[model samples]
Target: MKPTDTQRLLRRMFDAAIAAAQPALCVPPLLPPAPKGRLVVIGAGKASAAMARAVEQHWPGPLSGLVVTRYGYAVPCERIEIVEAAHPVPDAAGEKAAARLLQTVQGLGADDLVLCLISGGGSALLPLPLPGLTLADLQALNQALLASGASITEMNCVRRHLSAIQGGRLAAACHPARVLNLLLSDVPGDDPIDIASGPTVPDPTTCADALAILRRYRIRVPPTALAWLESGDGESLKPGDLRLPLIDTHFIATPQRALEAAAAVARQAGLHAHILGDAIEGEARDVAKALAGIALQTVRRGQPFQSPCVLLSGGETTVTLKGQGRGGRNVEFLLALAVALRGEPGIHALAGDTDGVDGQEEIAGALIGPDTLDRAWALGLNPRERLDANDGHGFFEALGDAVITGPTLTNVNDFRAIVIDGPPTEAP
Candidate 1:
């Protein structure tokens, strides 16, 4: 297969994966029965606005509420208010919106319904710090967590304890209302408590767990925050908390489902699709090295699988920030893979975030082929230096290999497709 054809196929698979997790397609079918009394919607995440829009279109009864999403991700909603805020970090807008969300569900009775739309990035989008903590404290903690290379679960454990709205606090505030949680999973394993740090779900982790994670990663916090956690003053609502209302949680979209959608696209193209795993997680470059070894084995020996096949995987990966260059885990993985492959022919790959934003850049991720390193060398670029500097975005953008998809309005973590084309004589 030609390189252009390979790139086209990879992109089609990614688009399919993204489309499969869209709120319009996944949210409506799984929506709970309409409440007998008031239906109040509340949410926070990159996809929460879209999820809220989906609810407005499908519900038969009148509903009104609030949802906070990352800036540039809001969709048109009539009844449910959509507020845009900063992501991967919290801001004043998110703080205010979170405060209002708590107020919106207050004083409700057993007949009322609180529909909570939660998804990836919600942890940062709903930054209602404890009374003694300030937004700046949350901001600093988030930055430290991002750079700590801790797993998503561990990071969210800390976030849940420090926040007033997350960790089932919002559900508790609903009192006698019935709370229905619609979650779009972006974390590995699709754990409900890990989604947006479980704003509407009970948290099994304690303040001690949060403190342990902080200490393990050497993340520092204010003296007041430390005293709160040590004193258990910031403890989250545990399971069986009487204040929490009757709650039901459902996953509308998950990384596994997205990977399956991409697999279907590959099969339709007459290519063999092998799903490696749906919840693979590790350091970015390390994961690339492991995947590159598998790809090489398939390309050289065809041992575990035959040629003319595609290897697909989905999950969130982390990057330890040691350099100053712009980096996203997806792009970092591609760059590392390119270095490991060392321009091996008949191998092409693409890795991207379904949300269309990888790290802080608007670019989704990147694409790599056998000639990726060659093209870089031709332009006097050093792949090793770029990788060392954590400049995957800069390196890929310079080679015109960066994949840009603006505001996909969904989040299913990362999508990776490794395409290995067989020799002409052995082609299927």
Candidate 2:
């Protein structure tokens, strides 16, 4: 029942990835110079509260603000108020906090600064729907999008249009004041505007583009929402908008950084690190199958990489919810990889969301050892059935392999590592 060396290495890599994105570590060194006037901070996302605390610790000028984080991800701050809200689904609490954030920035002088801490899940954490769209409408649409398997960019594009505060609208609220948006990117490509729907940055995606995405995904929208989009009433702040010129943005942390940190861990452990890509994206199961194939090749033929190497990948993956089991993209990908690998020797893998929560669950993801499939079968759990049912969480939970690092107060989407050792040597 002792843990293997590969398992230990996998957990270490995950921890390194999470540590690389922590707000305290990544946000402080990049803090902007204080403004002449009061610095008013505001933000929304899983990391916003932590990011706010980082700003308060480093900032010298007088400051006050509010930030919204997903419930249970909050950190204490003296000057900045932290509000917890639902994520991946907006709640009334998020709406209220978002409103307060906007109000806190009003009437600032040209010399004043608005510090906006933004990260993943902000689109749901700052749901200030435009006129005529009820919270209920947004809630329903968000549920659809979560189930629709839409890419993060597509989902945020739609969100930017529907929100009153997102998509550079928050920057517009600051008007004459200088706006500094410190963003921790969780989306592929690290697009600042897509992080938390870009509340303090210009939105390049149009309402027309939003409409196109919705139609492509066949996500049902209320007639009011449809009409609003068609009329451009929900349009976000565009690139040419005058208010955006004063706004500045910095990507304080990103998925690529996280992956690189993990890669460093692998090299320290004497394993050659092969980073496939930092922005890999696709259906979770499909991506899992592809990675498994590559891992097999490395083990069987030593083609892409030699033995004793670890493959690292980071980025967000999607899951099209159809079955009735608890699901998360990370677990889904891990489970599918387990199925594809089928107890393949000398290969162990781990996948988890860097935020410490995956697919609306507190569980980050799960680990897959070479014996993963055999042990699951012995425990009466069918990996194939679980994957088919989209029960990735359930499947891994039954095996007690779920990685449960709750509320790391950061978000970088997915972190995956596959270690391939040489063929098992004969045992005495």
Top lDDT hit? 1
lDDT of 1 by residue, 231-297 (tens): 9999999899998889988899999999999999999988889999989999999999999998888
Q: Please, what is the whole-model Cα lDDT of each candidate in the order they appear?
A: 0.92, 0.89
TM-score of model 2 relative to the true fold? 0.97
TM-score (all chains, Cα) for each model = 0.97, 0.97
By summed lDDT, the worst window of 10 consecutive residues in model 2 runs over 419-428
Clashes of 1: 0
Residues 1-428, candidate 2: write the lDDT tens digits: 46688899999999999999999999999887777888888888899889998898888878998889999988889999899999888999988988888898888889888888888989999888888888999999999999999999999899889988998898898988888888898988998888988888888888999999999999989998999899998888888798764978888899999999999999999999999998999999999999999988888877778879999998889999989988899999999999999888999999999998899899999999888998899999888889889999999888888899989999988999999977523321
Question: What lDDT does candidate 1 reach at residue 255?
Answer: 93
